[model samples]
Target: MVQKRKYAALFIGSALIVQGLTACSASNPNPNSTGTPVATGTAGDKAQTSTSGEKVTLRVMDWADSEKPFREKFIKDFEAKYPNIKIEYTLMSVDQFQNTITTAIKSGDAPDLYPIPGNMSLSMAVKGEWYQPLDPYIDDAFKNQFAEGAFVEGSTMLNGKIYSIPAMASVPSTLVFYNKQLFRDAGLDPENPPKTYTEFRQAAKKITEAGKGKAYGIIEGGKQIGRWKLAAMDWSALGGSGLNQQSPISLVTHDANYDGKEVLDVMNVFKGLKDDGSFHPKTMSISAPEARALFGEGQAGFILQGEWSIGVWKRDNPNLDFGVMAPPVPDAGQKGFLPRSSYSPWIGMSKTTKHPKEAALYLKEYFNKDYQSVLVKAGDRFSILKEVNESSSEIPQFKQYYDIAQKYSRLVPNPQIRNPELASVYGNYKDVQPGVGDILQGVVAGAIKEPNTALKQFSDIVDKSLDTAIAKAKSEGAKVDKNDFIFSNWSSDKNYSQQDYKSIQ
Candidate 1:
């Protein structure tokens, strides 16, 4: 799930206090600003303290309040290990963090370390030099410690330089969680879940029929547009086609045919369920969290969600019996594809940090196996280190999901679409008319009669957006070619490869 920004103020603990002047000034150096005193820690070496025996305090910021316990533990351990250094951890709401951090950075008062917000594209951040490249501090031995695909291009790397490390393993948002007891009560085999879309729809009908208004076959929150888009992308990929599954902007490659067939099929599935009275009555009215709550309360038989939901369900409904399943495919024997990026919630150093050496030390320790274990065991997030995950004591369900992510997931399309300049142009075309999310919501709510027409309109808007972005990029002296958008030999059956991109070029 993308980390959204929060707008409300949160009461942080006294231990994590905000130091220095609350107000900004031209001459009064904010300790959090990039202009603070620089530490002289050598690249790939341990941090050294000042000759005067002064303590070095580094300010770190993140928005995950749920992970506060783990963060506190890490801080305690880190300070114990390095007696000369101290860490002041600050937890903020997502919205406030992004807003305040951006403002602080502009005023030269950015935190020493913070997470790269999900809404902020990595390419844009790299281009703006907001993050300090970690290549200098990360030696070959350090780089080799992570799994082969842990550090991915367009996520952790830009122009062959590393700027950040992934805070957790990539978890695809396509997995489905279903109530096994609900299936059994509906006279369906709990052991044999639906594999094809036809079977899935039939199962939903049976469950709903059995409930007679007390339960729904499936549940989804239509109020959140992003949830709809995610569901559409997941189902389209299962149907062997996807419009924007690979990237924010759909690239019309030569072999990648997005004629709206796959999307239409997906939309029709929801439409069929809606018409059959299989979906929750409030599906279109609630938010994603509310939908999850309904599902946990045994109001729905199945829910399409990510691995993270496992922990949520366990915490909220301890007695609920649930099982994870791969998304339904178009055909019985066909395999479902999972679209995933390389890294998420990337942690990095601020370019203007006063203590680069101490920050590097903190980062190195952050990825340490011992520290990663705390994140895995306490936070329930998958570890980026291969060894930690392989030997994890996490629940068997999460381990199973991790295995699927490792074997079945494929990286999204080329890094070109991440270009900040191109993204700006493409974003303008997204809402030229009702977006895909709006169209899908309308279809499920019985507001849209023709899914094909709506999909075709969305496709045209995307094509025009791509064209506009290409033209603007060229005018700005960016060496972008229109042909880069075309992947001649690409196929949904297999993952996209450099060879496919090379074939078109």
Candidate 2:
């Protein structure tokens, strides 16, 4: 008998780093200088200060406009605690952050500290030395404060060094948030939510039939091709395909399994939903915000979204009554799971910063339990600290969210999806004709009659792209092999593991 894999025991591994030296020339001299002798120390060591009495201001940059409240509080608390250090907070839009940071770094005007943008691969940033390693400041005692496995390989640790520290826990990419009143109006049981894909489909059909053309069973941002593909893969993963969370390149390159009946079933579900007219009529045309508005206004019964939606919907539609549920599974008895990447964007300092000691002190305060508590209470995001999670009664709503996260979520390893060179190559291919998103959109729009055919085309494109990337990497004398792409012992039923890739190295 084949040994069935278990979800709880999976441990994701760090990707092997092929180090190359790169240097950044300073364009701005003494960017963090206030002529102050600030205190700094390793994790367990007592912070020591110099005799200089001048104050130091640390410039911090991030695209977290919505987290203004938490940011304000953090700065206030941090400044109050450390009178010699002041934080200069700079906010940029997500679209502009990557370019802004890149330009700033190249021109030697980078902030003393900043978040690694979600769109920028961490490996690439590390390779370019965009962020200074935090290893020297972080000792075992400091690292012990975080939950076990909080320090992920690709995002924080690369080439045996700690580059960044995660500020938030891994959040589930897909969750079912349904309006309770809408379910009741549709003659469905609000308390007994969907447990499997079959029940979810039946409920959607019933809700749509009950709408009398005024409401929809589900609402999605179909006009946003990337988001649409994400939803498709999220739902597909719910059917036990496991390929949903992996990048398109990973699928074709065999870093993730692409050939499975469950994968095909996911495509069929999308087609069936379209055929059944279960989606909002404007789903294929409207943006995510518009779709969200429709759902908030009680024009849709259900919407698949992330934890962030709860606060938004509550604020925008104060009267609407809704509840959250885990994503459905392939069968009733099988446990449903939410897919989360092991690594999240972390806060890191720049190598060019002149105030390393003060900056490191600020990092320590930033992730302190007190600050984390304030952040959790403000609902900015969940904390990476284990104590904060254990003492979550301080924020009841967040505690509830944490419960769901702990119960239903599992982390997908980062290395395969986060390989910098491969990701860059895949990103370029994604813009060309017959891209993965294009194929998914075509299938959903009924243009591609056969999902298998479209998927085959997608796989072929991925194969060629992977071949070129691997060849280039090898020619550059990078230590990589085809074996890195294959995980023969992996089981879709279990959470992904580092052991899956151990043999390749």
Candidate 3:
């Protein structure tokens, strides 16, 4: 299947770095965290419900290492309050979680809470009855705590049914994580990293040459090939490829463009880096965690990843100097910007869960102001709340990220959001084998000599899959069309607004 990055996978290392809440003042842009956990949400719970009975264990599965420590602490605090409910949590790789969760759903044994598969659309999740309606459990008081547009049809709500809740703010998953020391050693300026595609390529080759087997130019978690797919999507967007930042489908032409020059050019650079011996020798087998660790060890000059690594490297390898920058773009300059989709829930209640009230209760508190404040205090993620985001602005690293995202991440047109009925378009869409990620992997590994031909073939197959999906949705008496994918008013830099959706009608 054509794969993409999961909503929460990008922030795995955003965990452990935080020591405690820092004493902040308006003057301190980079407020330092201290030595005690004091988020008021956990250690200072105001509403404690002591239920005395047999402890109810809720099964929860996730893929975010970033949320692990906080999740454990939250459970501990929650258990102290309830005293009758326990959380049984499972953390796994994105691939493993999706595979196991899918099997569990098919066997009528799904976990109490699980993330929707990266490959599944909201419509598909709804059609398969993967999540139970949460509306019954959500009180207006708890609901009002969320940001505006937290629930929408074809997203958190489907067909008037609330299926999920917001977990994190929308942020692009791709950014350049580079070693400052490596740049110095390679005779490159640490202050000015590569900005254009050619410069990026040359810099990698130069760094690899200087390393002389001690390090490499770049590293990737090649085992999880979606890493490359995400890099391609984000970097290629600057080329004005028209391909959606999240998928192979184009936002402009409403056609599959996996073979388009934008993506293929990015793929070629990835392949060239491999050919130049700029990739770490173990890049093909290492996981992202392993790669990040290697990068911390100064074994790689650069790693294409998210902003959260700033926290990880600072804590783990304090001596390793590094910097963050946007992925290198085409020499001609950036022609497009990244598209920011709305907040997507990383976890939702399973339809078969027995502890509906308890699970719903936890869901409501998951993104409350208290927890959000803690998240910002720890520099984990940008919260959906304006006030929490304002607090995060005091942290220098997060402030830097805010500037990058501001320039790159703009809301784009989405057909599913415009017309809820069009959700079937994604539900019925079939993903072909050796998808975007695998194709890039094959070319890099020398398994595919003709990368261009492979990409074109994949594009054709995916395009055909779209046609088949449209036909299937139509056959079921849903008004669907290929043309629905296009928003004529939207541009590469468009900030799609609510009014934009209304105007189409």
Alpha-carbon RMSD to native, per candidate: 10.0, 9.3, 6.0
lDDT of 3 by residue, 1-505 (tens): 0001124211111000000000000010112451222233331243455222556887888665554555666677667666677778887766676589888899998889876656666667777889888888667776666677667776667788778765556666566778989999999998899998889989999999999999899997777756666666667777777655333367855676767888888888888888888999989887666687799899999896554455455556768788778878888888788666655544678989888876765665565666556555554566666466775434465567667877886766656667777767667777676667788778777787667887777778877877887899999888878777777778778688888888874
Task: Tell me the spans in candidate 1 whose CA falls farther than 4 Å from its real position.
Answer: 1-69, 75-112, 117-120, 209-215, 221-223, 242-245, 248-259, 281-294, 331-336, 342-345, 351-358, 375-379, 403-434, 442-451, 496-505
Clashing pairs in 1: 5-95, 6-94, 6-95, 33-109, 34-352
Q: Quick one: best TM-score, which candidate?
A: 3
RMSD in angstroms, candidate 3? 6.0
**Per-residue lDDT of candidate 2, residues 235-262 (tens digit):** 5555555543334334223642333455
Error of 2 at 1 (Å): 45
Better of 1 and 2 by lDDT: 1
- Local distance difference test scores for all models: 0.59, 0.55, 0.66
Candidate 1 lDDT over residue span 274-376, tens digit each: 8989989999997655677799899999886555455455555768888777777775445346555434426778998878777877877776666555445
Say which candidate scores most in lDDT.
Answer: 3
Clash number for every model? Answer: 5, 0, 0
Model 2 lDDT at residue 442: 70
